[model samples]
Target: MDIVGDSGATGYGVVDPHNGWVAKMRLAMPNTRINNYAHDGAMVSDFLPGGRWPDTTDAVRRIGVDQPSLVFIELGGNEYYIDRDPAQYKANLETLTQNIWQVSPRSTIVYETIWPFDPRQSTSMHSWDEYGAAMQQLAVEYSAGWIDLRQFFPPHYADDTYTHLLNTDQIHPTDAGNVVEYTAVLNIINRC
Candidate 1:
């Protein structure tokens, strides 16, 4: 019942991992083993290891060993940040999904949309909505579930914003955001 993904799922913006969504979820579900395999700036595509992170295949192998009941993959922004080609990104993501299914047939996979960050949205790489839609499409294609994290995030341009839900870098979520994220996942898991 743990999770996976990039910096947002890795507690990059926080001082302690215990304050991250994974830890909060562990606290919420004491019986659940939420092993944290996420890394900062992780991509859906298979590639060399990032700082302290194994490549996608190795990571998936490790997670498969755990046989996680539910796998939450929060990805996409890194694809844009790395400026990956859209078609290639789609292929890479599909492959990753297949690998997960091959390794854990009984597991439930959920593809999460990136948060509603305006600057990232304005990038020439790809609109944030485009990424979200791509994730949704893949989720449906694979008969998996999807969660648009944007719904839990307040707009970046509100008159009184910066509710500590996101970091100043505007990429990853903050400690407060981790709380909201845990709530969002909990809600979705309950529904499922």
Candidate 2:
């Protein structure tokens, strides 16, 4: 399996991303290989021109020439930070889905929801709910997987108030938090 997205998927603020939850997954599977292309501060729209990372031509293109069997995506927080509308979020996700399917027809794509944040402190309020719906719709439309990680962290200003999942930044997950995410994702894979 391969992964891509923003800082959250990169295990930002934690140990080396490879040594993060991805490492846990690797340890558990042993035989399964996981490649992570999650860059820090990467937005869903960054794959295209006019956003940050103009160097990125396309989303799936960053995965190299090898076709991966599975891909887990976690983006949109940076998109929200950029104040992008949900329509654009949906469009970018659509393009990502199309590109991945084209590049790796046999690959199964799974979309992970962004971190749960206080909408009052965010740039746009509707982006969360709207983007979530968009992800679900796209998943169903493409026969892909969608894991709503929001359930793991319903935190607000205080990250560790409820669960010691979020870091002080209230964005990225802590080391233990990464384990939670990995466990959730692994559960889905085991069922399949």
Candidate 3:
């Protein structure tokens, strides 16, 4: 099976040196063809028609209607920057997830929860719990599975350390951190 990973899916580094879930999955199953399209700092809004973010339609086109075996969505963290209204966030996410199903009904869609963020990184525009809950609800509405990444990281890393996921900024995953997140994802996928 071929796998396409999005922003949250792309770990630290150009070669993606860290062992992300995709890397582990590929290692576990040598036959799997895994492609990483996940760009760090990507928002679900980016995949839409005219959003400032990168659009997935091009990526979807790259898949060429053949529909890969699986499409993993790791977005929404950046969406928090847009505004903090949980209801609005839910509506936007609902539309995006539904569109994925509509476009590739046969491919499995995995919606991952945003890891707990450091309050220091974000303005008071929204709360982390609200964003996390909105994502969970979207998973339920779409009949897709949700993976809570917060469970994988050390509890001590919950605060400003969240910003350390990327060396450049607090949002993107560093190489090592990406490996951890990837491992968490792999564990979840293995259970299924």
Order the numbered candidates by TM-score, best leading.
Answer: 1, 2, 3
What's the lDDT of the predicted structure labeled candidate 3?
A: 0.62
Global lDDT of each model? Answer: 0.75, 0.75, 0.62
lDDT of 1 by residue, 79-106 (tens): 7775667676777777777777787878
Worst 10 residues of 3 by lDDT: 1-10
Model 1 Cα displacement at 159 (Å)?
A: 3.9
TM for candidate 2 is 0.86
Judging by lDDT, tell me the better candidate of 1 and 3.
Answer: 1
* lDDT by residue for model 3 (1-192), tens: 333334556554424553555665677778767766666655665565665544454555444465666677777676665554778767766766666667777877777775654534345667767888888877787787787876655434546554445555445556666767767767766887
Q: Please state every model's RMSD to the true fold in angstroms.
A: 2.7, 2.7, 3.6
Q: Residue 120 lDDT in model 2?
A: 44
Instruction: Give the TM-score of each candidate.
Output: 0.87, 0.86, 0.76
What residue runs in model 3 are displaced by over 4 Å at the alpha carbon? 1-7, 13-21, 53-55, 82-84, 119-123, 154-168
Query: Higher-TM-score candidate among 1 and 3?
Result: 1
- Superposed Cα deviation of residue 120, candidate 2 (Å): 6.9
* Model 1 misplaced stretches (Cα beyond 4 Å): 46-56, 118-123
Candidate 2 — which pairs collide?
Answer: none
